[model samples]
Target: MKQISFKNKFGYMMGDVANGLTFGMSAGFLLAFYTDALGITAAAAGTLFLIARLWDAINDPMMGVLTDKMFRKRALKHKNQKVDKFKIYLLKGSWPVIVAAILMFFAPDGLNGTQKLIWAYATYIVWGMTYTFVNIPYGSLAAVMTQDPVERSSLAVARGIGGLIGNILPRLIVPLVLVQFTDELSKGYLIAMILFGVIGLVSYIISYYTVEENIVHQVSDVESTDKDGFVKSIGVLVKNRPFVAVSIASIAMLLGMMVNSAMAVYYFKDNLNALQLMSITGLTGLLPMLILAPIMSKVVKKFGVKRTVATSSLISSIIYGALFLLPSNAILYISVSFMAAIFMTIPHMLVWGMVSDCIDYNQYLCGKRQEGVIYGCYSFVRKMGQAFAGFFAGVGLSLIGYVPNAIQTSQVLWGIKFLTIGLPAFGMFIAFIAYQFIWNLTPEKQKEVVKSINM
Candidate 1:
């Protein structure tokens, strides 16, 4: 077995750090930015998210094909040296990603509503495409890093830590900063996003330089034309029962997660009448992840990824459901939210490891490994869920007539409560159902798949 050093794992983790910085910012605040700061209606902001993501439905898979082709060409040219196909994209793609992230937030206040919407659409689509350029390749890199299941879990843990920092910091700090500058929320967002963009660029550069791709399996090595290879790759992924099952479950889970994150600001401000409590909520959520990081490998080894995810999903559903009945005090709300966060972190930490497992399973079933394509397809579905979540949250808010920075009416308050709590609880139940009924990859089966691939 090929050994992945600590340095390699740390570098791989940093890629996700960069990813989380951009992704976390968008997932947590983009809609709020549009509605509150940019003077767009909630429905319009949601439309922007949906339209950009619709384009990703095409752009993601094509990037996967392009990534695989690049890997094959690099291997042919530099036969003597190990060429890192994914990292090359990370290095080159980071520039546009950084620029686009800043542009997405830096819309000119001088533009009319229509002009601003156009700017939002153009910059956001560019952000999504460039993001795919970096993210799909980065997500695909783990399958080629090392084949050890336990090691993959450990890598996921490291990535989880990076993800937590990248995700939580912006959520916690940015909102707090914005509250201080309520008179100039837009300016505050611009400064914060630019700062995050710079940090993301630096992190990507470090990750590109630090991580080495040690394991290589060329998907394009088969004796077939490019078109034939691409079609076959898609067929393999489509026919993969485990991949399909996991994808369904992932979409549900991500939809809930994104909706919760996006609605949190509104929930805290409008319902709880405490905007600063978001920092506390973010901190409490971070605690469980910190406690679990050191021992997640052991947990996965004992419970298995699917079981862990299923169990966690069910627990989260229960907690969210319980929140509806609990006293509406900040203390109780924070406590229940903390408990739900604990359960939610398990799946978040294990998801990438499970993706690596699916890649291996695909290779086991088919004689070729199309990591880029497989990861791309998976990402495509995940992005779809994210788009719908944003749309739902935006539309849901609009339906209840949520007014930005105003004292919300009772009906709007109830709607915000339902969005923050009820919708995610339902999403969690759907995820649990998908995993219970659809996923069939057991621990023993995963071992067999890995062993067969190694042989």
Candidate 2:
């Protein structure tokens, strides 16, 4: 096996920078933007999210199959030269991603509710599709980069660090700036997304140029054109116990996190009556991840990713549950939120590594490596979780009688509290149960699988 250089890892890490800038922003703020800025009703915004992401169920897997077929053909065409199958999409899709990110926030100022809603649907769907085009390939690239479990974990850590920087910095900065322009929040979001989009584009270009895919590693055991057909490929994935377990855990974790993120602005602004505290809270939340990034790989190596994730989820659930009991003190709230954030980072850091492991396990069982399709299916479940979270946040708020920019009643406040803390805590508990009981990819099993593949 070849050693992956720091430069290769850095290049791979930068892809997540682009991911954090575009997809992270969408996850963090798109729903809020729809309701609060674009003047779309919460129910409508949630429905839009549901429709778009549900579409990803078909769209993501198809892109996976398409990319897999295209990569096989391209590699065969240029057999002698080093070919990075995924980078082509990264390069081609980068600008469209940025454009879509910008456009998703650009509802016309004079449009009525119906016009704005229509525009929202058009732009959001485009953004989701373009995001799929880029992200599925980018994610699958890690499995093919190298077959080392430790190296894959390291790559995931680097990606996690990149995501933290890309995601947290904007969370801290954009809100502070936007709070000043509360009356013109749509314009504020437009400006912020444009700036972030440019940053994301540049990051993608850097990743495209610096990253190298190992064609030999990709084709070591399987033929370049050894596709199992789409339906069978998906069947193989679904029947893989480890993949299914991880997919379910991912859905639970993301659904909780998305709902928490979607409802956070409200939690800080309305519940605490301190809009600026969002930045402070966000900054506090980021601290644990930064502190843990250096030691994350070592921890995973010792306990295994599944155990680490389960432990983290359990701890996070406890912390989230504690929030309901604590008095509404800003200092205490920030302190507890920081602790919860730290625990939450564990799963985020390990998830891609786990996904890569599932890809490996799939190859071990099925004798074919379909990185694109496997990742696409994984991404589809993740997007489904996001859609469900968005829908829950939207309709849940409506059910609770949440009124944007107005003084929220006690019922609405209680609902926000439940969505932010209770809902995610419940999600963490579910994830904990899934990983602890269902996922069985032990460290010994991982080594066995990898060694078998190489032999």
State the lDDT of candidate 2 residue by residue for 1-455, as single tens digits.
67788998888888988988877678778878888888899999889889988996679988988887777777667776776678788799999989999999886868998999999999989999999999999998888788887888888888887887777766777788787788898888889888999899999999988887874534433353354577888778877878988888888888888898888788888898877878886677668777987898899888888889999999998998998677666667788878887898888887888898899898898878788889989998888898899899999989999998799998899888889888878888888988999888899998999999777
Residue-level lDDT of model 1, residues 1-455, one tens digit each, is: 67888888888888888888888888888888899888899999888888788887678888888887777776777776656768888798888998888888885858899998998898889999999999999988888788888889988887887888788878888878898889888788888888888888899998888887767655345223244567778788877877887788788888888888999888888788788888887688679888998889998889887888898889999999999766556777888888888888888787788888888888788766677888888888888888888888888889999888789899898888888888778888888887777777898998899889878
Could you tell me which residue pairs clash in candidate 1? Answer: none
**Clash list (residue pairs), candidate 2:** none
Each model's C-alpha lDDT?
0.83, 0.84
Q: Candidate 1 regions off by >4 Å? A: 218-227
Model 1 earns a TM-score of: 0.96
lDDT, model 1, position 258? 88
**Model 2 ranges off by over 4 Å:** 215-227
